[model samples]
Structures are given as C-alpha cells and as structure tokens.
Target: MRVFIRIFPLLATLTASFCVQAESLSARLADPLATEAMLPLRSASALAARVGERPCASELPASPLTPLDAVDLALCNHPQTREVWASARLQAAQVGVARSGWLPSLDGRAGVTRNFTDDSQLTQRNAALSLSWLLFDSGQRSANIDNARQLLDAALATRDATVQSLFLAALQTYYRAQATQAAVQAASDAERSARESLAAAELRYQVGIATPADRLQAQTAASQARLNTQRAEGDARNALGALANALGFPAQTPLQLAALPAVAAANEFQQDVDALIAAAQVRRPDLKAAEAQLRAADASIAVARAQGRPTLSLAAGPNWQRFEGETTRTGSIGLTLNVPIFTGFENTYRVRSAEAQLEARAAQRDRLRNQVALDVWQAYQSLTTATQTVQTSRDLLASAEQSERVALGRYKAGVGTVLDLLSAQSALASARVQRIQAELDWNIYRATLAQAMGALDYSLLQAAEGRP
Candidate 1:
C-alpha cells in the first residue's frame, strides 16, 4: 500500500500526459487540407472508421469542389497551416509594436499611501496626465525597427516553407497509396495463380501422373500466396491511413485517389544546372528565410551596440499635491539624457553575443545553400533515372504480358505443364509490381524535382497535365 501510494503521483502524471496528448489533435487542426480531404475519405473503409472524418464543404453549406479542386481548399482550411500563417500575421503585428516606440508614451498614476509613523493616516494622490517621448536614442530605435522588419520577413519565409513541406508530404503519401494498390493487385494475381497450380496438381495426382509430394508443395505454395495477399491488403490499408494523414484527413475516413494522372513524356531539352541553382538561390524559402535571419542578426548587432550609447527623452507631467491648508500644482517639462556608465560589462557581452549570433547565422546560410544545391542535384538525377526506369518497366511489362499469353495458349493446347503456366503468371505479377513501383518512383522523383525548384504550386497541375 505504501509503494502504491508513492507511485500514484507518477502514474497520475503519466496518465495525465497521455490524456492531454490524445486530446490535443492540434496538429491536424493546423493542416490546410483537413476539411476538404475528408469528403471522399468519409466513404472509404480505412479512413472512415477510426477517427471521425472531417466534414465536407458541401455538407456544411454552399460548396462546389471536385477531388482535384479540393487539394487547395483543404490546404487553405487546414488548422495547422492556418496557424502558421497566423503566426506570420502575429509577427507582422509585432512590427507595429517596434514602430510604436517612435511615438509618444503617456502614463496615468494614482496612489494611496499609509503612514507608518505617529498616528495612522492615509495619503491619497492622483496624477492624471503624463508624457514621455524619445527625442533621440543614437539610432537604437531605428535599428530595432529594422530588426523587427527583418524578423517579419523571416516569419513569412518560414510560413511558406511550412506550406511547401506539407504539400510535398501529401504528394508522397498519394504516390505511396498508389504503389500499395498496385501491390495488392499483384498479390491477388499470385494467389489466383497458386490456386490454379494447386488444382492442376490435384488433377494430376488423381490421374496417378503427379506424386503426393508435388501436390503438397503446390498446396503450401497456395497457402503462402493467400497469406501474401492478406499481407498486401493490410499494407494497402496502412498506406491509406498514411495518405489520409498527409492529405489532412481524419484517421477513420476512407481515402481514394481521384484518378491516375497521366504523366507527361520526358522533355528532350535538359534544363541547365546553373539555371536551376540560380532559381533555387532566389526562391527557396529556407534560403531566403535564412538570409532574412542573417540580416536580422546584423540588425541585432547594431541594436546591441547602440544600447551602450546615450538616449535623450523629452518628458512633461503635471503633479497636484494637497496638504493641510495648502494646495500645490506643479508642471514640469524637461529633456532627460541617460547614459549607461556601468552595468557589470552587460553591454560588452551583449555586443559580443550579437556578433556571435550573426556569425552563426551567416554560417547557417552558407550550409543551407550547400544543402539545397545537393538536394537539387540529387533530385535531378533521381528524376532522370525514374524517367528511364518508367519507359523500361513499361516495355518489360508489355513483354511479360505477351509471354503470359503465349504460355496460356501453350498450356491450353496440352503442350505445356501447369508449372510452366504458373511460372509465367509469377513473372507477369512481378512485372506488374515493378511497373507500378516504377510509376510511383517517377511521381516521387518528379515531386522532389518540383520541390527543389520551389515550384510546387498546385496551379502547376494544369501545366503538368498539358505536358506531353
């Protein structure tokens, strides 16, 4: 009982944490696609049962959207994406805060004080008017304002980067779902072919042409094939769940790809690497945001250095003091200058810190540039490989299909055994799987290329469709 009592608080804390985590679906709420992606998934088996699907636009009100049209709508409506955008807005509002320093500041004061000496008496006083304005700050206020502006630029870039990442995730999940679907079909084919082989073996055994061992082997193969099919089915469901998450749909909602998009033929002309790098250098959100951060850091250095200088302020206030049989009203206006003579080397350290921060940010910007270049190069190579693989896989699939047809014909003509037919079926299934995998790879690489180019705008869908 003592041990239980000792552990109770810890257990309670853990339980509380878990409950809070479960209740906080805040991440999905921030997604831009949460609402619109839920519509078609609501009827799908994988997504519609676990987590309550997001409500569709039409269900809520006057809404017109197709599956394709829903992508942007979902992005815009996603709670997470909206929150990021809202953060950008908040950062922009902070600029106002920095700018306000340039304006006059007013204060009102009212106080009541009790005397602790002699007879206990309360003193009440009120000052209703005040003024404080910065006449000069050695450019510190201006530098701070500049820093705020640069920070706002960084925030905007960060928001855009978040949007890009979300869309890329969605695209990857879609391609993965498509790949799993193909795998399921391939597994089904394998199962069917195994069953057919088992039947052939049984017929031969009954006619005394096949041994019991052969029949048993065929039966085992059929069982394994059935297991494979079941596994594929599970994988496909899991893929759907992942896709739903990427698309910002609820876990319980069902998801289906709208339709297989037609891929454009590869262009004969190759884009120059230098040109692509230049484009990325100009437009990549991470790079631009990093540069903004570096600029902000530079401004921060200025602010830190300025903090060591003198500040001049114009001040004016009216005071009213009342005493026994005496009343006094005082008005004062003065220019006050403040210079920090000493503060335990605080300013010196601050300036050093700011300079260090600036150096760190500059280094980070350089690192980001290098990483982006590498990513672009890798994506370009992968895209080229995917294009080649797609064409090759298609040709191989066609050849496998023809071979299977020929094998089936030979078997029906009594010139081929069931094993030969089964082999052909297996080959055909593999070819189909490969072809599907190739297509998925192509899509993934293409998406990566688009991302590297900072050209992942959904509006490009029109251009994508028009290509080839």
Candidate 2:
C-alpha cells in the first residue's frame, strides 16, 4: 500500500503524458497532409495538390489550355510526387524517434497467483512499475537526430527533382502538340496551293496553251498534297492524345491546346558554360539530395560508434504485493552505467560496415556531382543551338513563301511551267515544317535547360505564356 501510495503521483503524471502523446498521434494520423504542406509547392504552386494522399478532383476547363495550364495539371497529378512527399514525412517521424532517446520511459505490470500448499491455501497479488531515463549515450542520440534530419533533407530534394522532371515532360508534350497542329495548318495550305495550280494547269490545257503532261503532273501533285494533309491531321490528333496522356488524362480525352504565341518570347539563355554549371551545383535538387545522403551516412557512422560506448541511465522501480492477507511493499531508485562488454565482434563489424557505407555514399555523391555538371553543359549547348535554329528557320520560311508566291503568279500568267510551280510549293512546305520543328525544339530546350539547372518552377511556365 505504501509503495502504491508513494508511486501514485508518478503514475498519474506518466499516464497523463501517455494520454497526451496518444492524442497527438491520433490527430497526426487522422488525416493526410494537405497539398500545401509540400516543400516543393512553395515555389511551384501550380504543382500543388494532395496527389497521393487524396483523389485529384481536378476538372478540365472547357477552354483551351495554355502551356502553363498543361504543366500545372501534369505536376499536380503525378503519383511520384506524393511518393516522395510520404518518404519525407517518414524521415521526419524518424527524427522524432531519435530525439525520443533522450526522454524517460515508464511501464507498469500486474499479476495474480494462486498456490496449492499442504499448510495453507494462498493467493498473491503483485503490481510493479518501472521508470528509466537515459542520461548519456556518448552523443548517440544527437548523431541519430542528425542522421534523420539529413535523410529528410534528401527526401525533400528528391521530391523537388521529381517535380522538375515532370514539369519538363509536360512542357515537351505541350510543345510537340503545338508543332503538330502547326504542321497540319502548313499542310492544308500546301494542299490549297496544289489545288489552285491544278486548276490553272487545266485552264491552260483547255485553252491550248499547255500540254496534257503538264495537267497530269499538276493533278498528281494535288493528289500528293491532299495525302500529306490527311497525314498531318492524323499526326496532330496523335500528338494531342499524347499531350493529354502526359497531363494525366486518358488518350481518348479531348483536349484543345491554345494557339502558341505569334512570336515565342525570345529568352536570353546565353551564359558561360562554367557559370551555368556552378549554378547547377547550387540549385540542382538531386545533387543536394545526394549530398544530404552522404551527410546522413557520415552521421550513421557516429551512431554506430556511439552504440559501442558505455551509457549512463537513471532507473526506478516501485512495487506492492498482498500474500496470505499480509501486505508487502518495496521501492528502489539508482543510476546505472551500461558498458557493452562483448557482442561477438558485432560492434566492431558494425562500425566497419558503417564506414564502408559512408565510402559508398561518398562515391555516389561524387558521381552525381559530375553528372550534374555534364547535364547543365549539355542543356546549355542544346538550347544555344536551338536558339540559332529558330532564327535560321524563320528566315528560310520567309524566302520560301516569297519564292512560292512568285512561282504561282508566273504560272497563273502562263509563263511558268507546272513543274516550277510544284517545285516551289514543295520547297515552301519543307521550309514550313522546318520552322515549326525549330520553334518546338526551342521551347523544349528552354524548359530542359531550366530543369538541368534545378531552377524549373511555375515561373518558367508563366514566362513561357508571357504571364507576369
């Protein structure tokens, strides 16, 4: 009874602590985190959503989507985003686990027993409570906390990297769809021009000014142009379906993309390759994640070493027993120093294993670091080439348009051959295809460069649409 009375207050306090902790855990697990809790969404709100935590109820707008809108849908619906977000949360919980090593533990046990003896029948009731508080562990707790924090950091970086990759993907599909649409328009124009040439050839032959071969050639060119138009239209449909799929929609989902700007805003991405690589080292999330993993591995080594060291702890136990109708009570409190005497060379091997893991992580980080630099360099060169190609294609297109116009006029006036007309139209069609492709490449490369630098975000999408 005395021991029970003495320990009552301690039991009440510990029980209250346990209750609070249970409530906290219940509240934390009651619901999935809202999309706003994600670290990546701070800079890229367009990608914000409760991706895996909840169903995406996003409805497509009736109006055509611009490039930014396409990117937003793709990122928000990416299942991988939620996977990393969950991983980060898991690591955060582990950090809590590490910090908990500094806290005390309380436990209670109760039992009843009946004995059959020749002298007397007896019943016993026993209840005991134990308390233990870790006072020192050679900094193992701190090291564990550091490791968990680093892992969390790595998870966050990984999430960001995943989002950026998705962003680039959405951008690619959007640009490709636009390019296909433009090609369809160019093909239709060619078909119209071919039909007009065929009409002029027929009139000239009827008037005895052209040969039958000339009209036949014009007829053949018209048929070919009409075939090209049908192929272009089919390609445009396929491209739209691909874009829809990229944005997390079914291939059969109808999607209308907004017309690309008459002039895609020329971005000045020109910079020294060295400067870009340096920027990637700082801004690249994957590289940051790798560095964090290395740091976590380093901390793990500390944790492993600390596990082998002695630890100091405070412990207390209180108990009460009733036997043969007589009450007995006891209580004890003390400090204990626990030294790891031997573990069959377990600790020794553990430390070595930790060191080896640290080395592996270091090697991986270095490899990734080099890869980051290479990615930035390659993206920069590609974008530079795309920029030049866009301008050149535009010039070639202008000249082709003029040449085709002059050829059509001469044929209409009966001075140019149908062969010349068809040749000029073919050249014009090729130039148009080149120009559309150049424009698409430029847009994709722009997004790629931003992704390679780990600087891709909603702002890049906004800039593409000329949105402030």
* Number of the top-ranking candidate, with lDDT as the measure: 2
- For candidate 2, give the lDDT of residue 200: 93
| lDDT tens readout by residue for model 1, 346-461 | 99999999999999999999999998898888888888888888888889989987887787666555566666776787788788888888888887887787788777665455
Candidate 1: misplaced stretches above 4 Å? 1-83, 112-128, 194-221, 324-327, 341-344, 464-468
Misplaced by over 4 Å in model 2 are 1-57, 117-121, 264-267
For model 1 the TM-score comes to 0.78
C-alpha lDDT of candidate 1 relative to the true structure:
0.73
Extract clashing residue pairs from model 2. Answer: none
TM-score of each: 0.78, 0.88
Q: Tell me how far the alpha carbon of residue 215 in candidate 1 is from the true structure, in angstroms, after superposition.
A: 5.1
Steric clashes per prediction:
22, 0
